[model samples]
Target chain A: MMRLRLVTALLASAAAFVAVSAHADNLVTKDRVGPADAPKSFTLRLTNDGPTSTDPVWAEGYQKLFSEFIQRHPGWRIDLERMSDNIGQEQARMLEQAKSGNGPDCAAVDSFVLALFKGANVLKPLDEYFTKEEVADLFPFIREGITGPDGKIYAWWWNTDLRVLYRNKEIVPDAPKDWAELKAAALASKEKGGEGVLFNGGRWEGTTFDWLANFWAQGGKLVDDKGKPIFAEGENREKFLKAVNYFKDLVDSGAAPKRVATIVNYDEFNAAAAAGTAALFIGGNWQYGQLKNTLEPEEFAKWTFSEIPGPTADQRSTGTGGWTFGAFSNDPAKVAMCAAVVKEIYAGPGNALQQQLPTAAALYGKYDVFKTEANETFAKALVNGQARPGVPIYPEISNQIQIMMGDVLSGTKTPEAALDAANTAVQAAFARL
Target chain B: MPTTTAAAMGAAQRRVAGPSLARRIEANPFTWLVPVAVMLGVFYLYPILDVFRLGLTNASLVGSDERYTIVTLQAMFENPALLDILKTTAVFTIASVVGQQAFGLAIALLVMRGERRKLKGMVALRTLVLVAWVIPGIANGLIWQMLFSEAPFGAINSVLRMMHVSPVAWLSDPNIAMLSAVISNVWRGTAFSMIVFYAALKAIDPTLYEAASVDGAGHLQKLRFITLPQLRAAILVNSILVTIQTLNTFDAIISLTGGGPGRATEVLSLFTFNTVFRNYDLAGGSVLSVLMLVISLVLALFYASFMPRREVSE
Candidate 1:
C-alpha cells in the first residue's frame, strides 16, 4: 500500500511538472532555446545573442523576446541554434550546411557573405512575406546590399556596426585625427604605464576587416565591377602600400606591442580596455556596450570614441559590418514564421538592448539608446562607413590581406614584398575562380 | 533389415551430418577474417581511396562546378608556401619528439630509482606526470597560452618582471611561436613516452645490474652498456609513435598560436586544414592530405626497418 502511494505521488508530481512546462510559451536556456516539441518548428542560428554568462542584459532580453515571439505565434516553435561567434567560421559552416541541405530554416549570416549564399541559390526572397511598410523602412545601403541581381530582397539586413578608435579620455584628452598623432599619443600612454594601442593584427578576418578602413580611407579599390583583382594595380597600389606601411610603422616605432598578432578577436581588445590596460584600441561600436557592462560606471564614463584615424586628417573612412537574417527553407509557411521571428528580434526592442545600430531608418531615435553621445558618434561614423566588397572573391582577397598584415607587422616580410605576395595570391585565386 | 557393417554405418552417419559449422569455419581461416576485412575496407580503405579520387578533381565546397584536373597538385608543388610548411613540420616534429623522449626517459629513470629506494613521493610524481597526458589537448593549449602570454598577469612574464627581465613575446614572435608550441606539445606528450619507458624499465632484468655492479661498473657505465642496449626497442617504438603523433598535431598549436605570427608554426596538418576549411578548396586539401599520408608512411617504413625482428626475451 505504501509503494502504491509513493508511485501515485511521483506520477502526480511529474504531471504537475509537465503542466507547468507546457504552460510556458517557450524555452530559453543555455542548452536549448525554443518552443519545445511543437507541431511547427523553425530553427534560427544566432551567436552570442542567447543566454551568455558574460552579459546578463543580452541574455534576458533575448529570452523575453523569444518567449513573446512564441506566445504570439501560438502553435509555431522557433528553435534558436547557437552558432560560432567567429564570422568567417560561421559563414563557412553555413555555406557547407546549405549545400548539404542540412541548414537551419533561418540564420544570422554575416552581411558580406549573403551574396555567396544568394549565388548558390540557397536563400529565399523576403519580399512577399514582409509588410510593404517594413520593407520600405530599411536603410538604403541595407536594401541595396540584400537585393539580389534579380531585384528581390533575399535577406533582412538587421543591424550594423562601425570600427572606431576607442580612447580613455583620462589617458588622452584629445582624439587623434591622423596616424602620426595617434602614434604619438599611443607612445605617450605607454610611457605613462599604460599598454598603448591595440587592434586586430592576428591571422583572421578581424585583422583584415579592422584595418581595411585605412585602405578604404585612401580611396583604394579592391576590385572592379567585374570582380577582377585590381587593388595591386595602378594608383591603387601606392594607396594600399601606404595603408600596409602604417601598421608596420606602429610596431616598428614601438607604439603598439608585437603581441597584437595574437589578438584575433575584438573581445581581447574589450578585455584590455575593461582591465584599464589599453589606453586606446580600434574596435567595433558594439564594444561600447561591452565596456559599459564590464567596467564600473565611473570608469565607463572615461571611455569615448572617434572615427578611425586616417593617413591624413582629410582622409577618413570606416568599415561597416552587420548581420542579416536569411531564409533557407523552401516551404512558404516556414519562411513566413522565420521572417516574423527576425522582425521581432531585429526591429523590435531586442535590437535596442543588443546595442548595435538598427538598420531600419524608422527605428532610430525611437529609443534613448540611439540618442546617447557615444552612439551619436557611431552614427556619424556609419555615414562615412564602407561595406566590404560582396563579390565571391572578396573572401580570398581578405584572407591574403590577413596573412599580409601578420607578415608585415611581425617584420617577417617587407611592406613591398608582402603586398606583392598578397596580390599574387589573390590574383591566382581569382584566376582559378 | 540386413545387418550393416561398421564401415557402412560410419559412412551413413558422415553423409547425414556433413561438416559441422564450427569445423567448416575452422577449416578456412579466411572466413574468420571476413568481418575485420570488411571493417578495414569500409572504414579505412574506402576513405583513403575517396581522398585519392577527390585529389584528382577540382572540387570546391561552395561552387557547383567540379571536374577532373591535376592543377591543384601542380599548384601545391609549385607554391613556395608548401616548402615553408614542410620545413615547419619537420622542425616541430623533430623538436617535440626529441624533447618528449629525452624528458620522458629521464623522468622514467628517476621514478624507477625512487621506487627502488622506497621513496615516499614516487607515486605522486608519476601521477602528476600522467595528469598532463590525461588532460585534453585544448585545455593544455589554453593553460600554456596563459602561461606564455606577454600580458602583465602572464605567469612566465610576471616571473620575468619580478626578476627584472623584460617580457618576451612568446607567441607573437615569428620564431618563438613555434618554440612555444613545441614546448607545450612536449609537456603534453612527455607523459606518454614516460609511461612507455616505465614499463620497459620494469621489464629490464635486475640481475644484469647486479652483475654490472659486481664488475665494478658505475651507474653511468651500466646506463651506457646494459640499460641503453635493453631500451633500444622501446626507444624505436616510442620514436615511431611519437613521430606520427607530433606530425599530425593540430589542436594544441591552434589554441596556443593559431599557427600564426605569419604561419611560423603551421604544420602539414594545419596547412591542409587552412586549405580545406579556410580556403574551401576540397581538391587542394585532399592533395595535401595525400602528401601527408605518404610522408607518414615513408617515415613509418624507415623506422620499422631499424626495429628488431624479435624481442629480447624471445
Candidate 2:
C-alpha cells in the first residue's frame, strides 16, 4: 500500500511539471514593437561575438540597441553565445548539437553558407512568421539569396558588402579604367618598386569570388543561364583561358605578389595595404572603414575606391556578398518574435541608414550622411555588382575555381590546363546538382 | 567391518578435498571483483553497443532514411580527395609519434642521470611541457597560427627578418603547412611520452646497472642492452597512445590552417567534417568516419600483436 502511494505521488509530480512547462512556453512579453502580442516568450539561442566593448564603434551601437531591447522585453530572454570565428568549425559544432535533438533557436549565417544549412535542413523557414508585405521591404537581391529554390526564406540579412578596387591616390593620379589599362598600371607600379595589385588566391570562397567575377567581366561564363556548364565549350573555354593567362602574367611580372598562393583572405590584403606594402587591393566597403579606423588619418586619406576594371573600356564589375540572420526553430510564436526583431534590425525606418552612414563616418572618417550624394553613388555601383552563383553546388564550384587560381598563382599549372580542369570540375558539380 | 571401512574412506576424501567452488571463492577473497565486473558491463559495454548501433544506421544531421545500404561506403570511395587527406593523416601520425618517442626518451634518460640538485630544473621543464599538453587543442592551434602568420608583422616573420632570413609562408604554402601542423602536435604530445618514460626509468633496478658496471659493461652497452629492454613495455604503450592521439587530431589543423591553400593539409578527419557540415553529405561523411575508425582499430591490433612479448625481470 505504501509503494502504491509513492508511485501515485511520483506520477502526480510528473504531470504537474509538464503542465508548468507548457504554461511557461506559452507566456509572452507584450512590450515588443510589433502589432500582435506574441503568445510565447522564446529563449532564442543566438551566436554572436561575445558581449564586449572592444568591437568597432558601429557594432557598439547595435549592442546598445540590443541591450535596450532586452530591457523592454521583461518576459522574453535571448540567450546569446559566442561562436568561433571559423565558419566551418562553428557549423560542425552546430550540426553536432542539432543531431542530439538540441539546436539553437536562431543563428547568424553568411549568405554564401545559407545553402549549406538549408541542404542539411537545419534552418527553419521564416515565411510563416513574416508576411508578403514585410518580405517585399527587404532588398530584392538579399531576399532572393535567402530564399531556397523551394521558395522558402530560410534566413534574414542586415549587413551587405561588395568587392571594389581600392587604389593609392598618391601613387596613381589616375586609376586604370579597364583590364588592359589596369595591367599596364600594375606592371608600371612593379617597375617603380611597388606592388601592382593585391588580392587573395588562397583556396577559399574569397578567391573564387574574385576570380569568377573577374572572369565573368571578361565575357567568360562558367555556367549558362540554363545552369548548364559552358566553360568546356569553344568560345567560353577560350575566354576563360585568356583571362587566367592575363592573371598569370600579372603574377609573373611581379605586378601581383607571387605569395598570393599564401593569402587566405582579404584580411591579409587589408593588413598589407595598411602597411603601405601594396599599391592597390581589391576589397569590400567594410575594408574602407577598417583602413580608416586602423590607419592614421593621413595615410587613410591616400586610399579611394574604384570599380573593378572589366574587359571593355567602359565596363566594370564587382562581386557582392553579405551576412544574414537565420531561424532554426519551428515554434510559431518564437519564430514570429525573431521575424519582428529582424525587421526592426534590418528594414525599420532608420536602421540601414544609421548602420551605413555613421559607421562609415566614425570608423573610416568617410561620411556621406545624405544618401543622395556619394552614398548613392556607392549604392548604385553595388546594385550593379554580380553575386556569386545562387546554385546549391556553389561551394564545390568555388573550390574548383580556388584550386585553379592557386595553380595559376604558384606557376604550377598552365593557365589553359588550370581553366580546363576547373571547367571539368564545375561541370561535374553541376551534373550532380 | 564394511560400515567402519566406508566411514574411514569418506573421512579421508573430505580431508583431501580443500573446499567446494563457492567456499573456495569466499576463502580466496577475489569474489569482491563482482562489483567491478558489473560496473564495466554497465559503463563500457553499453556505450560501445550504442556507438555501434549509431554507426550502422542512416542517421545524419538531416533526417534518417528507413532503409540501410552500402551507399555511404560507396560515396566515401567516390570522393577523390579522400586519398590525399588519408596520405596526409598517415604522414602526420607517423612523424609525430616517432619524433615524440625519440625526443621524449632522450629527455627522460637525461633527467634520470642528472644530480638531485639539477633535478629541480628538469622537473620544472617537464612541468612546462605538461602545461602545453594541458592547454586545449583549439588554443594551441591559435597560438601556432600567430606564430606562422605570413605577414611581415607576424611573429615568425618578424623573427626571421631579425635573423636576416627571408620570411617563410608557414601556413600558406602547401609544402610547409603540414610540417607546421606536425610541429605543433609534436610539441603538445612529447610531454605525455616523457612522463611515461620517466616513470618507467624510475622503476628500473639500480642494482642491475651497478652489477653491469662491475662487470665492466660501458654506458652505451648498458643503455642498449639493459635500459632499453627494461623500458620496452612503457615504450610500446606510449607509442600506441601517441599514434591514436595524432591520428584523430582535427582541431589543430582546422584552427591553424582551415585545410586551405587548395586543401594542402586536410587530413581524413577534416575531410569527413567538410563532407557532413560544409557539403551536407551526411552518409558520405559517416562512411568516411567509419573507415577512419576501421583504420584506427587495425592500427591498434597491429600494435598489440607486434609489441614485445618477452617480459624482462630482475
How high is the CA lDDT of each candidate model? 0.85, 0.69
The C-alpha stretches of model 2 lying farther than 4 A from their native spots are: A1-39, A49-60, A70-75, A91-102, A116-138, A148-154, A190-196, A219-236, A239-243, A313-315, A348-377, A415-433, B1-67, B115-120, B215-219, B310-314
User: How does each model score on TM-score?
Assistant: 0.91, 0.79
Candidate 2: clashing pairs of residues? A156-A325
Per-residue CA lDDT of model 1 for B105-155, tens digit only, reads 999999999999999999999999999999887789889988997766678
lDDT of 1 at A127: 92
Candidate No. with top TM-score: 1
Residues B220-292, model 2: lDDT tens digits: 9999989999998898888778888887788887667766656677788877777666655555666676777
Model 1 over residues A1-433: C-alpha lDDT tens digits? Answer: 9999999999999999998666552366554455567688877787776554247777877777776667777777666677764456677778889888999988888887877888778899999877778877876677778988998889888889889999999999999999999999999999988878999887777888889999999999999988898999998999999998888889888889888887767888777876778999999898888888889999999989998999999899998889888899988998888788777766657568877798776777787888888877777677778888877788878878877887888889998998898898777777766
Q: Native-contact fraction for each model?
A: 0.51, 0.31
Kindly give the stretch of ten consecutive residues in candidate 1 chain A with the minimal lDDT sum: A24-33
lDDT of 2 at B197: 94
The predictions' CA RMSDs to the true structure, in order, are 5.1, 10.6
| Model 2, span A203-259: residue lDDT tens | 566777876666777666666666576775888877777767777787787678666
